[model samples]
Target chain A: MTKPRQWIERTIEVGLFLSALLSVLVTLGIVGVLLFETVGFFKTVPLLDFLTDTEWTPLFSEKHYGILPLFSGTFLTTSIAMAVALPVGLISAIYLSEYASRRVRTILKPILEILAAIPTVVYGYFALIFVTPLLQKVIPGLSGFNALSPGIVMGIMIVPIVSSLSEDAMHAVPAGLKEGGYALGSTRLQVATQVVLPAAFSGVVSSFILGISRAVGETMIVAIAAGLQPRLTLNPLVPIETVTAYIVQVSMGDTPTGTIEYQTIFAAGMSLFLLTFVLNIVSYLLRKRFREVYD
Target chain B: MTPDKTKALSADPTHAMEKDIAFKVEDLNVYYGEKQALKKIKVDIPTHSVTAIIGPSGCGKSTFLRCLNRMNELLPNFRIEGEIIFDGQNIYDKNVDVIDVRQRIGMVFQKPNPFPKSIYENVAYGLRIQGIKKRDLLDNIVEMSLKKAAIWDEVKDRLAHPALALSGGQQQRLCIARALAVEPEVLLLDEPTSAIDPIATGRIEELLRELVKSYTIVMVTHNMQQAARVSGSTAYFLLGELIEFDETSKIFTNPGDRRTEDYITGRFG
Candidate 1:
């Protein structure tokens, strides 16, 4: 009877272990497929030309396969997105965690989270129709389908991501630290700015980095709102194409499976994956290094 | 020996020291939301004396201590009624500034909560908040405060090290030094040594006894023996009420209330 019970427990433990193993295997399989396709694409298009060429016109008969223009466009949009998102999101987090009462926090936190839950495609249309037209009134150079509109909308979409994570980190700071500051005769603002913000700095940075990763990988908003012209331009007021947007553009159109044009999407996908993967790892490390585990 | 003798002793002018009262609480009642925590407490904390409030867990000792400095005001649902007079003025008055009161009356917590900063920065935080920018002045005050807390010699060499890197006792001493740097007239400690080891506790108790010479000290502790050893006066609280307050020796040896006796003698909490 004891042997049977031990056997039953062992079986259950093995079943749970197998489930965990399966998840890891599935992730590796996806990455393996991406790597295989990316390698095959790189063979057809010389690695240097794929990385260094400034123009990407895969649809035309004379296809020039340079990924630099796409990269520059992606960088421009993401930078604008971060510039808009970081400060607003962080301040909102600070306001929620430090200033708001419990009832207010309960009301506002869910509202902010709902912003994140909105479908990306809805934000896409809003940027294309409402934001672009509004910007066209103020700036003479603003295009009908510009990166600025989509970047601004993407920033709004990612605000909740940064605010929620940052709020959690700020809340995790021990109450004793704040009390210590108060007892030292520091004002509420002083305590929040000097002591609490500094203590939670790494967590805040991690949140910002995570937000940047989300902005970089974001697809639907940039695809619908920003024009699909991978021009190498720094001006956010002009139309630009991001890596995700390029992939979406290529995949939506008709292209044969064996064509080089089709493989370029895989190359862009690989670059996007690598960028976000590096960011995720760095954010994870920052959290580990700076987290204060108060006993 | 008795009340008559004490009165006679008080009559001597040269030996009769007249000290100002640091805190006077009259009919002070505290409530946390719907639950009453402190019930009509009336007491006077003499200036520059080590007074310890001793009781079991949840007996309102810490609550009463927090009320003295208005630290309880931090909680949104915490309510207090009645008067708390500090420095000859009612701290609860409408015109009184709560921030100024807190600045003058510093507090140390149960667990060591040194900011995640350098040792020098931790000691200099209070002064810095007051906008004191003179490097020489901050340096002198840091050294003096650390010396007063009996931690100067150990930490002087590692002034730039993180405060969190210190040992438990050293950290508590650092917190005491941090409080002292602001030159507060009174210091309220809530179980300051409870989270520390025995050696650190002993060091902190010794430091408290030394601190009573210049600053008024009010401490809440669950350890009765510690209260007796470190305090000049003792107050016993139980079930949200003050049971007895008197000389430390008398309270420990012959408490006026049976609840105080039961608690001190380990009969029941």
Candidate 2:
């Protein structure tokens, strides 16, 4: 009986360990595949031109494989999304966590989460049909398939993500800190902004990075609302294609499997992964660099 | 409860005041939801004097100390009954804002909570909250308060550094300086030196002794010797009741209540 029990324990332990190792193996496999294909893309299109060229018309007769267009697309959408999400999400989070009565918070939190749970495809249509019309009233010459619509909808999608993460962060701030704030005769807003907000800065930054990363990787909404024109421009009112949207466009079309066009998707994905990875590292390091240690 | 009685409770304008006291309490009781933490605690905290509340763990001395500044009321289910009269006004009156009460009466915790900010910012925080933004004004108060807390010389050069980098004693003194910067009428310290070393504790006690000349001090201490040394008046508490309150010498030398005597002599907690 003792022998069987010990053998069983060892078997279970090994199984758990191997299960944990599978994630690492899968990640490495993905990196390997991406590097193999990105090398293929760089062979046909020079690495410097791919990065620096003004145009990104890969499918057109006058071909230019500039990666800048996709990067800027990702940059604009992520910026607009963050501009929408960060303040709205953070303020709502502060209100929910700090000031809202228990009944109101209970009612509001689930409603915010449900907004997040709505399918991204539905949000795509909402952007094109509902949001673009609203924006067109204010700014003329706004394209029907523009970056602004998808960016705004994507921001709405990430709102719950930002608010919930930020709420959790603000909630984790020790009650002692807020009590100390009150002890100094600070008003509720002062305590929330001056003390609690600073205390939860790292968590709040982590939330923003997570929200922006989500916006970068978002596919369906951008593919539907933001047109397939991968033009390198900063004007949000113009139709533009993000790297993820471009990959979606090509994948849905008849691009031969073994061609350079096929490998370009992998190259795009590799850059996307690197973009998000760099964002997480940079924000976390920046937060830690200037933060005050409470514990 | 009526208007005329309320005026009389605050003391009539024609009446000549005798002892300068910080707080006058009546039938003060505090409860955490269902369970009572303090029962009928009635005491006078004299103005410009150090009053030490000495008790064992869970004896409600800390709870009583928190009641003065309405700090205990911050807990979700905390409920208070009766009145705490301060500056001839009931601090718990319906019209009285808890923020205003806390501003005039400040508190320091058992552990040094220095906001993880710069030494300069820690002292400036209270004044900043009051909306005085002139940098020179903040600088002067920060210097004066830090000097008053007796940690100015050690921290003057490192004012911009993170407050947590300071030693435990220095951090506690910094907290004191932060409290002092607000110019509170009364300062409540909840075991301010419990976590520090003997030398640091001595430094803090010395600072408190000097501080009582201007601000009234109410300190909760686990150490009976500390209570005997620092406080002008001492209140002995046991099981959520005020067992005795008198001059520090009387409580330590010849306490009136048996429970107070037993606690002082270390017969039982």
Candidate 3:
């Protein structure tokens, strides 16, 4: 009986080990696939040209592979999204954590989480149909499919992410710290801004980086609302195509699977992946350095 | 009973001698939702002295101490009644700005909770909150406060180092220095030495004698020896009631209440 039990335990251990190995395999496979296509694309378009290109018109009859246009679009939309998300999200978080009663927090937190659960495609339509038209009434030069609308909509979508994560960080600040601030005769505003905010800042920074990462990678909203013109301009009034939108545009069309146009996306994919990976690392590092060290 | 009559009746013998009272509690009742944490707590805490509140765990000692500066109002379900007269004004009055009340009454917790900043920044926090931007003024106050707390000698060289890098005892002292920098009229220390080692406890107890000259100190301590050694007047509590309050000497030598005697002698809690 003991021998059979020991055999079964060994079998379970090996099974558990394999399951753990599966996660590492998934990450390896993604890197492997990206590198395979990226290498092919770089071979046709010189690495320097791809890096330094100011225009991204590869699909045109006269092929030009300037990747800057795509990058600028990605940055522009991400910046707009961040501008919308950061203050709104952080203030909402502060309200929830510092000012809101427990009863209000209980009622409102899930509703905010529900905003996160809304499908990104629905957000895309909301941007295109509702937000763009609304903004056109105010800004005369606004394009039919400008970066501003999608960026703002995407910002709204990411608000819950920023607010919720930041709220967790602020909540993790020890009650003793808050009480200490109060004891010092610091007003509610003083305590919140000076003591509580600074104590939870590393966490807030992590949330911002993660929010930016989420914005950089978001696809459906930009594809639908932000127009398919990868123009290398900072003007929000002009139509723009984010890196994700360009990828979606090519993959949806008749660009042959193994062609240079098709493989350009893998390089773009690499850029997006590298961007988010760096952000996640920074967030992780900041949280570790500050959170564990303080009381 | 009338307020003056009640105050006269509850006045312990030391009250006649100690002319400057820091706080006077009268029928101070505090409730956490429906459950009563303190009931009819009435005592006179003297100014420029250390008044140690001693009680068993969950006996309303900390709650009573918190009520002096209206710190208990931060809790959602916390309901407070009766007056805590600080100096001449009622601290619980609606017109009183809680911010000013807190500025005058500083508290250090059982755990040392220093900001995740440099030791210099930690001591300078209270001053910064008050919008004192002059670097010279800040430096003078920080130096004076740190010197007063007696941690200046140990931390003088490494003032820019993160406060978290300090030893546990050092952190508590840093917290004390931070509280003292605000120049509060009264300092509330809730078991400030409980989390520190004996050597650190000795340093804090030694500092208290000097501190009480400028600031009125209200302390809640579980250690009976600590109460006897550091405090001028000691108030003993049992299940949310003020059982005995008198000169620390009398409480230890000849407790007026039987329960106080039994607890002091380690008969039972």
TM-scores vs. true structure, each candidate: 0.92, 0.92, 0.95
Tens digit of lDDT per residue, candidate 1, span A46-83? Answer: 88888788889877888888888888888887887888
The C-alpha stretches of model 1 lying farther than 4 A from their native spots are A1-22, B1-16
Model 3: per-residue Cα lDDT over B6-93, one tens digit each: 8977899787565578898899999999999999998998898899999899999999988887889898799999999986889889
Output the worst ten-in-a-row residue range by lDDT, candidate 1 chain A.
A286-295
Top lDDT hit = 3
What lDDT tens digits, residue by residue, belong to model 2 across residues A1-295?
6999999999999999999999999999999999999998888988899889978887777888888999888888888988899999999989988898778989999999998889999999999899999999998999998889899899999999999988988888877778778888888898899888887888888888899889999999999898888888889999999999999988999999868888889888999989888988987896787455555
- Point out where model 2 deviates above 4 Å: A101-107, A138-140, A287-295, B1-18
Model 2: how far residue A256 lies from native, Å: 0.3
In candidate 2 the C-alpha lDDT for residue B232 amounts to 90
What is the Cα-based lDDT of residue A1 in candidate 3?
66
Cα lDDT tens digits, model 3, A200-233, are 9888998899899999999999999999999999
lDDT of 3 at A294: 52
Judged by DockQ, which candidate is best?
A: 3
Q: Which stretches of candidate 3 lie over 4 Å from their true place?
A: B1-18
lDDT of 1 by residue, B178-233 (tens): 99999999999999989999998988998888889989999999888899898988
lDDT of 1: 0.90
